[model samples]
Target chain A: MQYERPKSLMDAASLLAGAKGSAYALAGGTDLLVIMKNDDFDAELVVDIKSIEGLDEIRETSEAYTVGAAVSCAALGESTMLKEAWPGVVEAANLIGSTQIQGRCTVAGNLCNASPAADSVPALVAAGAKAIIVGPNGNRTIPVEEIPVAPGKTSLEKGEIVEAIQLDKRAPQSGDAYLRFIPRTEMDIAVVGVAVSLSLDDKGLVTSARVALGAVAPTVLLVEPAAEAIIGTKLDDAALERLADVCSAACQPIDDKRGTIEFRKKVSGVLARRAARIAFDRAGGK
Target chain B: MSAIAVSTTINGDEVEFLCQAEETLLDVLRERLGLTGAKEGCGTGDCGACSVMVDGRLVCACLVLGAEAEGRSIETIEGMANGDELHPLQTKFLEHAALQCGVCTPGFLVAAKALLDANPDPTEEEIRFWLAGNLCRCTGYDKIVRAVQDAAQELRGS
Candidate 1:
């Protein structure tokens, strides 16, 4: 197979645009290699964009936190600013595989892979993350929720690559957390994952909330009704129960080896409640 | 196919080589450079037998492309000792009887070196967490954990 290492974004884009047959962008190669080995994918050419300088940066500006597509999960987990500003984001990155996998796995790859069980997608969706897509057509921002249309499918067109993930700069008077239920601890995919972000008013009432669930459907789902169940409430046991019920009802999980549909639905509710509780605590709730 | 030119410091020696487009670091280290200290127990990242340090970061060699190591410094199990004198971790592993089969020893040594280099004084829990990537099938990891602790103490005393 032909391998192309482009040193500039435009160069990479031009290479992608000029490619004739099957070609794929090599970010960290954590996921791509596995797919390639399984005989599930065949690529005539592989473009290594990692040599492009400035693509591995994690920059926080007055407006938003922009994390490059090539930034590894280990880098994200170790970023103190990211942990403080977007705790859920940090937690999501940390939850991907293990330290060894994280050393080479990129957040962009995780998003681009578009696995229903991707640990970072729900958290990013909950945080209202946006993808900066770059191509010959120019750069544009797409919502994280819109990036994945189905399991193992992405909205990215040919010659398009994710530049970075952008999150709002405003540190909400809120807390966020991600929790997943896996059969094994160290190296296992999530059976059900839940990410919650809650903004609390001064009086300890939840002013706004976002609840996202993973592994329970074809795409990482944002349960708006579940979030609305807790927003504007004190987030006490009753509100949490209502929210859990909504989350359980929202999922359309299928029975798989990892878990049964009934188990996933039940665990989804439990995880949603638990993550919401942690988020509420982090938001300085009583 | 474009051959990628990689120039890096391996085992304290500055070297340059051309790697095939699809070659992984594990393949280059084992086949091209003949630094077979890093073993590929599993081509996937699950098994840590192919652990190595790439620019001060402990990573699975199998997961990283050879081209990714360009301009980076790498330390393998072969680089641990200074001539005959073994590194503190290596000595401790020997003294503590950390390995039974010796297949996972190299990876454990490289991973322990990384941990000690980062935190000279790490708690047992920290050691366990840091070494979680490296797995030992023969030695239930109790002796390995003790060896790492002893190595930390010895390195700190020196």
Candidate 2:
């Protein structure tokens, strides 16, 4: 294997594009290293993006925040500003692995790995985050949900790189929360994950909302009906019931040893309701 | 394949080594530097048996590339002791019987040191959550938690 730590994004892209065999970008390398150790990876060229300028930075403004692809999950958890702005996203990303993994795992790597049960993808999607994808040609912005097209595949073209993930300026009277049901308290993959982001008007009426689910489909699902269910209401029992039902109705899960189809469906609804309730309370319900 | 030359600071000492492209930090520490304290219970990040601190951040050495350790400050279990005196966490772990086979002890000590360095007084929940990556297969976590709590108290001079 050839490991090339390019000092610039342009150089990195060219190196990746010009590889003769399997080329991979090394971020935090939590997942990539594991796969490589198991002999499942055949990489001839690897571009270490951490050497690139600003690729490991977290840029924050009042309007939005952009986390560089190589930024570790530990950095995300430590940032009071980032956590204050997007608690759900930070918590979700922090919950990916153990404390040690957080020190090395990148949120970008998590998205690129494209696991169906990714802890951070749902929260990123629910927050309307966009991934800034750069490639040999140039750069383009794509929604977080669109990046993961399948369970283990991404929509990124050859030589394309995720520069940073940007969360748009959040509106006031809004809060987001993420919850995943695993068999253990930690260090376990999500059997079912849900993220709910909602905003309330002056009267505490739900105005804008987004609900996303993970591990229930090929990719994380941004359930429109689930979002639609809670909008234009105060998230009362009826609205929340509809929200749960719609969220559950959108699942396309497969029966696996970890969870049956029926169990996942039920948990999706239950988790959706619980997550929405938390979001509602966090938004300072009147 | 040409070996990668890496310059790293471990335990306050500047160290240099050459490692292969596929070599992990844990491999170099154990094989080259003879820092055998950081065990390799599971090469994957799932087990924290190879946990270390890179630039003050707690990380599993197995997940870090050996070449990537260049110009980084690393702290392994070898740095956890002070001459003849064990660190408070180590002292408490021995007292609390936090180990069975002793394979996971070094990793736990390193991880706990990182935690206490950041937050001297962590809650029980915080300690459990922070150490969730370190697994003790032969023993349950009750003693480990108590050891950490007692160590924190000891370090606090309480």
Candidate 3:
């Protein structure tokens, strides 16, 4: 195996495009290195993208925030501006692993790894995040939900790298929150995860909202019906109940050791209701 | 095997070594440079036994490639103490009898130091949460937590 730290996106793309065998783009290496160390792992090249200038930065602008692919979760937590703006995204990223893992893990990697239970994806999806992709062909931007096609696969083509994740500047009275259920308090994968992002009008009616569920399907799900249940309403008990029912109905979960199918379906509703309440409160709802 | 030459700073000393692309920093530290203070409890990042600080961020050495350490600074368990004198955390650990088997001591100490460096006054909940990644199989965590608390107080000089 060979390693190359390319300082340019084009160079990284070309390196991956030209590789004769399996090639991987290394962001944090928290997930990559684990698989690389496996006895049966076979990889011919690793292109480390950390050397690229500004790839580790969180660039904030008037319209949105551009989080570089190499930005660590720890760095995300440290960014007070990001935390204040998108607390759900920041908290979800911080909850990926322990402090040690957070120091090295990247949200871009989490998205690329395509784990249905990835703690950050549901929040990012609910926040309507976009992924900036750089490839040998050209650069393109796509919705975060479109990147993951299956349990362990991504929609990225050969030689394509996710350069950064872009989150839009939220409007006034906007808030988002992410919640996951695990048997343990920390350091365990989510049994069921839910994220809710909403914006309320002066009358406390939800102007816009998004609800995303993780660990209940092959990929993280954005339930429009669930979002619709709360839109134009003040998220009263009836509206929240409708939102929960929509979330529960949308789940296509499997029975695993972490949770039974019934349990996941039921808890998905519970968590969606709870997360929506938190997001509503954060948005200054009554 | 083709080996990559890397120049890095470890424990305030300039060091250079040859390592493969896939060799982890923990492997390079323990096998090449003879810095075995960072043990490999689990080659995966779950076990914090290989915890170390790279460029001031605490991470598992087992998850970082040695070739990626070029021009980076690392702090390991070997650097926790200054010369013959033990650090406050170390002294407190000894005073609190924080070890039954010594394998996890280095990791716990390194992780604790990182916590103290970031937050001088950590609550018990914070301490427990911070040290959750570093598992002590001997179940000596209560003493370890006490040692860290004592060390924090002593370091603060209150």
Give me the runs in candidate 1 sitting further than 4 Å from their true place.
Answer: A39-41, B1-3
Candidate 2's residue-wise lDDT over B1-158, tens digit each? 89888898999999999999899999999999999989888898888999999988999999999989988999999988898889999999999998898899999999999988889999999999999999998888899999999999989889
RMSD (Å) of each candidate, 1 decimal: 1.6, 1.1, 0.9
Give lDDT for model 3.
0.95
Residues B18-113, model 3: lDDT tens digits: 999889999999999999999999899887999999999999999999999999999999998999999999999999999988898988888999
| Best of the two (1, 2) by TM-score | 2
True contacts kept of each: 0.50, 0.84, 0.79
- Give the winner by lDDT: 3
- Position B28, candidate 2: lDDT: 98
Error of 2 at B111 (Å): 0.7
Error of 1 at A163 (Å): 0.6
Pairs with steric clashes in candidate 2: none
lDDT of each: 0.88, 0.91, 0.95
Query: Considering summed lDDT, which 10 consecutive residues are worst modelled in model 1 chain B?
Result: B128-137
Please provide, for model 3 over A26-65, each residue's C-alpha lDDT reduced to its tens digit, 9 standing for 90 to 100.
9998899989878999999999999998999999999999
- State the lDDT at A72 in candidate 3: 99
Candidate 3 chain A lowest-lDDT run of ten: A181-190
CAPRI class of candidate 3? high
- The TM-score of predicted model 3 comes to 0.99
